[model samples]
Every structure is written in structure tokens, then in C-alpha cells.
Target chain A: MSARHHPADAVLADYAAGTLRPGFDIVVAAHVESCERCRRHVRLFEKAAGAMMSDLPPAEMSADALPLMLARLERNPPAASADAPIAPPRDTRSLIERLPVKRRRWLAPGVWVQPIDVPQLPGDKLYFLRVAAGIRGLHHGHSGPEFTAVVSGALRDGKTTYRAGDFIECDTEVVHRPKVLAQDGGCLCIAASEGSLKGQGFLGELIRTIAGV
Target chain B: MTPEPSIETSEPARELAPEDLIVAIAVRADRDAFARLFQLFAPRLKSYLIGLGTTPPAAEELAQEAMLSVWRKAAFFNRSRAGASTWIFTIARNLRIDAARKERSALAYAVDLSEEPDAPEQPDAIVSGAERDLKVREALKSLTPDQVTVVRMSFFQEKPHSEIAADLGIPLGTVKSRVRLAMARLRERLEELL
Candidate 1:
């Protein structure tokens, strides 16, 4: 199936530009893996990113940069890192499987979180959140930007219902109370939040205490 | 590694585009051509890395790695898919990401299931890569200075939207709107070329 919702153009542009925080970039990548529309948008942005890089005024390099690079090229065959195991181009199952599944931890009675620590985003947070069917998940407002990409099942946050491959972005102003859609077998999503969660009501405070989001 | 003083002062540098240099290297495995490509892009790549928050020494290393990749992967360069500048720039970008993530999978941003580009209402099938690049350049020019500033800060500075808003002393909504407006215009202009 196709994605009904996708990340904003700014989000995709940042992703293509290689400037997005590693925490958010992976979630966006997973969504792009499954959404053809977003994939095409990202390609257009990639071209734009390339053009922008070309337009920047030149900067001085260390004097030995060229000589060193040339020497390396002559002495070595192309680095074999390109042949390293990349997530298969078309199949995302392999990519998802690569997540830290064995380390998953339960956050609440019916909620589980598997943290994915990206090296670049040591200060930020990325994790997989799984909520069992019929369970109302956390109700909270973001202290910073929060991005979520649904990988399996579905979630309903107020008026919008996000299904697999759907991308959702919530800023400080967006206070959402997401519930696992009862029809689906539960919901599994990879979420990247810029900072801490700011709980609103009493229930939100309880979740905040428990999840430490 | 021998010092090629002539290449440093060559007049052909004025006439040869980066795209031509890449094609030269791809077709003939020309060291001089690769050197020229290295001369043109390495500094810029280093600058880009520094801007992305990498230290100067680290940026230099990454730039060197990127150029090496270009030399070995020249034959894979498809002019129709990406221009030489774009290809080299992508290599540098990927190198930075790889260093940060320390994963062979860091280039996953370029990996997508759908290889086909979206078909627009008016199919511009004959548009060349150069033409597309020109269109993109023109679209960029069409953006207002405010929009352009916001876009640059977002893409080049690697600043979050909130940080961009703070740096420019503008409201967060304004920053988002500027980015949204500029991107919508770009998408409309480039949709046919896709």
C-alpha cells in the first residue's frame, strides 16, 4: 500500500541535505523506504541539495588534502566499505530487523520502548515505541520537536489516524494523546524527539514519570 | 603525490566544468582529470563538513576520503543521474554521515524502494540533466532573500528549525513558513523535470 501521510517538505529537504540530526534522520529514512511519494520528493531535494553545495563560496583546505587523497587512491583499491552490508534497497524488513530488538524494555504495563542511540545525537533521543492493542498510550506535549514513523499497525492521535508508513511530526505546540488503534494488532513506531516530554495533565505526568521521555 | 605546479596554474581550469572533468576521469581513468576534480571540490567539501559541525582536521580527513571514493567510483558516475558536482558532493555528505553513525548503513537516506520518479501532469521527458540543474538554479533565484536565508540556515548550517528561528531573531512560525514557501515553489518548478 501507499502512505497516506508523510513528513513535511522541510523535513524531507533536511534529510536530503544530510543536515538532519541522526536521531530524526533514521525515522525519516524508514518512512522513505516505504513511501514512494516521499522517496520521489527526497530525490528532488537531493538534486537541490547538490546544487546548493556547488553554489557555496569555496573554502581553503589544508595544503596536504589533495596529495593525501591522491596517495590513498593510488595505493588502495576503492575502499571495500561500499560493499558492506547496507539495508537492502527495496526490502525494509531487513532494515527493521537490524534494530535492537533483543534490548527492548517495558516502560509501562502495556507499553514498551527500545532505545536506538545514534552516535551523532548523543544529546537527543530515538526509540521504538510499541503499544498493545486497546491501550491508550502517552498523552503529552513535546518540549521540542518529535517525529514518529509508524512501522507496523496504527495509532490515532485526535483527528488523524496514522497507519504503517505514516510519518508524524509534533512540535512544542502540539499536544497529542495517541492511542493504539483497536482494529490493528497494536502499534509499533520509531520516534525521534528533540528533547524531553512536557506532560500536561495528571495522566501525562504519570507517563512522563514512568517513560522519562 | 608529486607536486604538479602546472595543474595549479592551468588555464583549462577556467574552461573545464566539473561535469566535464568527471566525464574525463570516468571515460579514461585520467589522473590529471581526477586531480582537477579534487582541486575543485575538496576545499568546498571540507568547508561543508566544518559547517556541519565537524572539526577542521576531521573534515580534512573526510574530504580526503570522499575524493578517494570519487577516483575509484568514477566509472559509476552517470551524468543523467547526477552531475559531477552533485556526485562528488554526495560522496562527501555520505562520508560525513558514515563517520558520525559509524555504520555501513548510514547512506540509507539514498536507499528507497521506488526507483521511478513521480510523473507530473506535463511530462518533460527530453529535459537534460543540465537543463534540470538550470531550472533548479532558476528556482533558487526566485526565492526571496528571507526565504533563501532560512533555507541556507536549515540545510547548510545544519541548524534545527527552532535554532534557525532563534538565530534569525524570527518567530518559529515565520521560519517554518519561509521554508515551506520556498520548498513549495521549488517543487512546483522542478516537478516536470522529475
Candidate 2:
């Protein structure tokens, strides 16, 4: 099913233009992979980018550029088979499951965190959060931007229910506690946040310590 | 001074569109077609990379690599699905991302991200890929000059929206709004025309 929530247009433009931070890009990709509407938007943005590229003033190539390219072509001729076999359709595993996670830390009775190994600057965090059904997460706000994509089940933040494939982007000013829906199965999400998350109080601090975020 | 005898000045291939040249390469293994394609795109790719902060030599090397990929991947080109320039631009963009990831020693994830199943065809998508490309180019003309400037800076130069606002001496919110407005306008215009 198509996602009800998607990343903003400006965010999609950044993703298409390849300017997004690596961690943020991955979360957006997970959403884009599941949402066809957003994928079309991304393709449109890419077309615009291609048009802009064609209009740029051409830079001069080195004097021997053509000759050098010809040499490389000669050394490595085009393969005999022009048509490669089609790639098999991807399996049903969630995006988080496909990634090579470094470790899984037990945070609470119904929750755990797995940090995905992606190159990141200090203060940046990218990981997967799995909350068992009916569990409520810590009340927190972000110091910078935080992006999340629901991989399975549902989460209730305020009035909205973010189901599988839905995208959520929260800025610094927003603070709220989100809970996994009681009727649905547990939820798994891939999230990338800039700077450390700001926990609200003592309980929040304890959850943060156990989650190590 | 006399002009050099470059492929750009040649008679038959000079008239072919970039798309036709790619088709020629795919159907016949035509070297001349490949040469024409290289002559048209390599320099522009280099200029693009340079704008994104790659050094001149590295940009030049990457441009060559991108063209080499075009040569190898020509058979996969589906003119009905995407314009030659759009396809080539994606190739170059992926190479740049790969190069950046290699430099950081990060795991290679960008390629796999794109490998997910393509969206099912939309019923309203009646326009061919080439027609869509042309319409998008026309829609770009409808945007105000200021909008165009931000689109170019943000998409081509890789400037963060915050940095763009700083460069333009405007508030950061204005920069984000301009981008959002410009893209919405483009999408609306394309829908109307297509």
C-alpha cells in the first residue's frame, strides 16, 4: 500500500540531487522504495537536474583526453553479451533486516536498538528501533532534525498513525511521546537523527542510557 | 588559425540527437556514435563535477569513467522510458556518489537503494519519456529567474539550503520556501502540459 505520509518536496529534491547527508539519505530511501508517488516525484526532480546539467558551460578536456579514452576502450572492450540477466525481484525482508547491523542492545522488556554501521560525523546517529506492541517510547525532542521511516506495524504520535512505509520528519521544536499500536504487531523503524536526542526527564534519561542514543 | 578536424564538425552524425547516437551505439556497436556521444557530454560532466567541489583532475577522470560506463551500458538504454541525457545524468550521479562513499570507506548502500522494484506504471502517465523531458525543460522556462537560480544552486552546485541562504543574504526559511515553491510550480506545469 502507498504511504499516507511522505518526506517533504524539498527533502525529495535534496535526495534526488544527491546532496543529503548519508544517514538521512538512507532513511529517505527506505520510504521512497515503498512509496510510488514519492518515487515519481524523485524522477521528476532528476529530470530537472539533467536539464540543468545540459545547460552548463562545457569545461575544456585535456588535449589528450579523447586519445586516452580510446586507449582505455581498446584495453577493455565492450563485453560480448550486451544484455545482462534481469535481477531477481527483491525479497520481502524489511530494509532494516537487510542491513548489516553491528549489534543489538536490549533497552527494555519490549524494546531494543540496533545500530547500523554507516560512516557518520560525531553527534549523528543512525539505527533501528523495534518496539513491541503497546509500548510507549520516551518523550524527547531533537537538537537538530530527526527522520524516521516505519518498516512494519504502526506508531501513534499525537492524532496520526504512521503505518508501514510512512515517513516522519521532526524538527527541534516538536516534542512528543509515540506508542506502538496495541492491536497491530510490533513496529520496526529505521531512523537517522542529527545531534543527540533531548530526553525530557529522569525516566527519559534512563531510557536514553539503555538505548545509548 | 584553422579549426581541428573534430567529430563535432563531421557531417552525418552531427545532425543526430544524443538519443539517436545512443541507439546507434546499442544497435551497431558504432564507434563514431560513441565518439560523438563522448564529445558532447564528457566536458559538461567535468564542469558539473568541478561545480560540486571535485578537483579539476579528479573531475576529468570521473567524467571519463562516466562515459565509459555509458558505452558499456548502452544496451540497457530504453529510449521510451528515459531521455538520453536523463539516463546519462543518473549514471554520472551514481558514479560521483560511489566515489564519495569510497573516500569515506563507508559501506556501499547507494546502489542497492536504487535496486528496489520500480513503481508500477501509472495510468495517467501517457507521455513518452522524451516528451516528458521536453515538457520539463519548457516548464523550467516558466519559473521566475530567482527560482531558477536557487534550483541551479541547490541541485547542481550541491549547496545546502542553509548555505544558499547565507550566499544570497536571505533568511534560511526563504531559501527552503523558494525551493519548495519552484518544485511545486514545475510539477503543476508539467501536469497541465502533459
Candidate 3:
């Protein structure tokens, strides 16, 4: 599916350069897996990186480096093919299913949160939030940027509707409540937040206290 | 290892391009070809790692490991998909990421390494690796020097736009715009080539 909303060009460039924080990177990657245009953008950025690398002045290697490499090569044979499995065969599961979820916590009656096991800096958080159709999410503002990739179904925030594979980035200035479209069954989103949520209302504060998002 | 007459010695007059050298290793398991590839890229790879703030000794080790990966994964090289340098750069990039991940946590985080199924090919995706590399180099040259500098800082030094703006003593909005403009110019130039 083509993604209507995408991460900004600078973010994709960072992803290409391997410079994005792990939490941000995972969210972008999930979008890229489904969005061909962003993938093309990433490829171009990577090509730029490769070209720049090719033109850099060479660094000195230790004199014995080549011989040491040759010795290591003698012990390791080439893989039969690129597709030859280094990891176990990946089953035909959705991205959310493949990820290791730490635990599921009920945030509300129809909404539950499952934390994805991703390495993050002390203040950063990554998790999946699945809200049943017609449910309105907590009204909150981010302490820092929050990235979300829609894994399934659809949600509407403000005027824009984000469907499966769409990406949304919320900065500190964006404070709003989102609702899942009733026709879409439910919405599952993988979100990465740089810092805690600033709850706007009493209910928002209660959910934030319990969810620790 | 049996001592065979060196391919370099036998063919002293002919110089194989990096792409051909990889193909030679893949098809014939040619040691001399692998040696030639190493000589061409190992130093450059080390320099790249160093540019990204790796300590010199660690960069050197990572470069060696990257080249070793190139050797082991030679059979997977598809010249049509990526040029020698681009492919090698990706190898080094992945190694750096993996190394950083290891430093952060002892338990392996389930980062998905499996190749996602290919999307339907777009028009530009069909461009051959060598041609695309050449086009990319040309496109880069077409960008303004300031634009190039921003691109380099973002890609090589791994600086966020805010950090880059701070380093350059410019506004963050200017840095963001420069990056956006640079990428647009590149896409335009490459599209013209296509």
C-alpha cells in the first residue's frame, strides 16, 4: 500500500546514513517497508553517502591488516548465496506479529498497549497501541517528538486521516486527541516517543499515570 | 591454501574495475581478485568509519570486518542492483549499527534483518548500478557547495539538523531547508539523467 503520510526527507536521509536513534529508525523503517517512494528516496540518499565515502581521503591501515584479513578469509568460506538463511526462516507474519512484545497493559476499556522490545535511550519509549473502533484517545502533548506508524486500520487526528502504513510525527506543539474510524474495525499503531506525554485533561492524566507513556 | 601463480602477476597489464573484481571472486573464487578489491576499499572503509567518529583503532578493525563480510557475501553481489562502492558502504553501515547495538545491550534486540518483499519497481529503480552511481556523483556535483556541506555533515558526521545548525552557527530552519533543497536538486538531476 502507498503511504499518504511520510517522514520528512531529512529523517529519511538520516535513516539512509544510519544516524537515526533506534526508536525513530524503527518507526521510519516500518513505513519504508510499505512505502516504495520513501524507499526510493532512501536509496538515493544511500547512493549519495556511497559517493561521498568514495571521495574521502584514505586512512592508513596497519601494515599487517591485509595479511590478517587473508588469514581470516582462509578459514571462512563464502556463503552459497545471498538468500541462504543466516537467520531462521521468517514465517509469513505481519510486522507487528514478528516483533517481540514485552507485555500488554489495558489503558482503557477498548484500548490496550503492547510495548515493543526495542532498545532506547533512557527517556525514549516505543510501544504499540491498539484501540478499538470509535474510541477517542487521550488528549496529550509530547515533551519531545513522537513518531507513529499505522500497522493496521485507521485513525483520525485533527483533519487528517492516517491509514495502515501511514506515518505521523507529533512535536511538542501538537496537542490533540485522535479517534479510530468505526468502519476500520480497530487501529494498531507503533509509536516511538522521545519523552513522556503531557496529559491535558484529568482522564488523560490518569491514563498517562497508569500507562507510563 | 595451495600456492598458485598470482592472477595479478599473470595479468599484469589488465586492470579490472571493482565491479568486475567482485564478480571474479563470486564466479571463480579468485584470491588475487579479492586481494585487489581489499586494497582498493579497506583503507577507504576505515576512513569512512573514522569520519563517523569511530576511534582510529576501532575503525580499522571495523573496516577489516566489513571487507571480510564483502568477501563472504561476494556471491550475493548483484552489480545490477548496486555498484561496488554503494554495496560496500551498506556492509560497513550495517556493521557499525550492529556494533552500536551490541554496546548498548547484551540481549539481542529483535531488529528485523530479513529483506522485505520488493515493492513494484518504479521507473528509476531499473537503472543499472554503475550508471546510477555515475548519475548520483554527477547530481552531487550539481548541488551548491553549501548544500553539499549540509549533506556531508548529516550523512558522514551523523549530526541532527539542530546539532548541525548549532555547529555552523546558523538557524535550525536554514539547516532543514538546505537539506530539503539539496535532496530535491539531487532528485531532479537524477531524473534528468533517467
Best by DockQ: 3
Q: Model 1 over residues A28-71: C-alpha lDDT tens digits?
A: 88888888788777777777777777667777886776677767
Q: Looking at model 2, what is the TM-score of chain A?
A: 0.90
True contacts kept of 1: 0.52
A1-213, model 2: which lDDT tens digit per residue? 889999987788777777777688889888987777887777777777776777689999999998888778776655443345543454556455566687888887799889988666577889999999999988988888999999999999999999999999998889989999988889999999988788899877887777767
Task: Fill in the DockQ of model 3.
Answer: 0.46
Model 3: pairs clashing at backbone N, Cα or C within 3 Å: none
What is the CAPRI rating of model 1's predicted complex? acceptable
- Candidate 1 C-alpha error for residue A67, in Å: 3.0
Instruction: Quote the lDDT for A199 in model 3.
Output: 87
Clashing pairs in 2: none
lDDT digits (tens) for residues B1-194 of candidate 3: 11222444445313666777776677667777888888888999899888888999999999988998888888887654566887888788878877876432111112322133224546445455456667888888898999888878878896667988999899988987998888678766755663
Which is the better candidate, 2 or 3, if ranked by DockQ?
3
Q: DockQ (C-alpha) of model 2?
A: 0.42
Give residue B41's error in model 1 in angstroms. 1.4
lDDT of 1 by residue, B1-194 (tens): 11122333443643566665655555555667778888777778877878888988898888888888787776666555566666777677777878877763443554732234344423334344456567778777777888778777766887767888888898988888989888777766666544
Q: How many Å off is the CA of A70 in candidate 2?
A: 1.4
- Listed for each candidate, the true contacts retained, as a fraction, are 0.52, 0.45, 0.59
TM-scores of the models, in the given order?
0.85, 0.88, 0.88
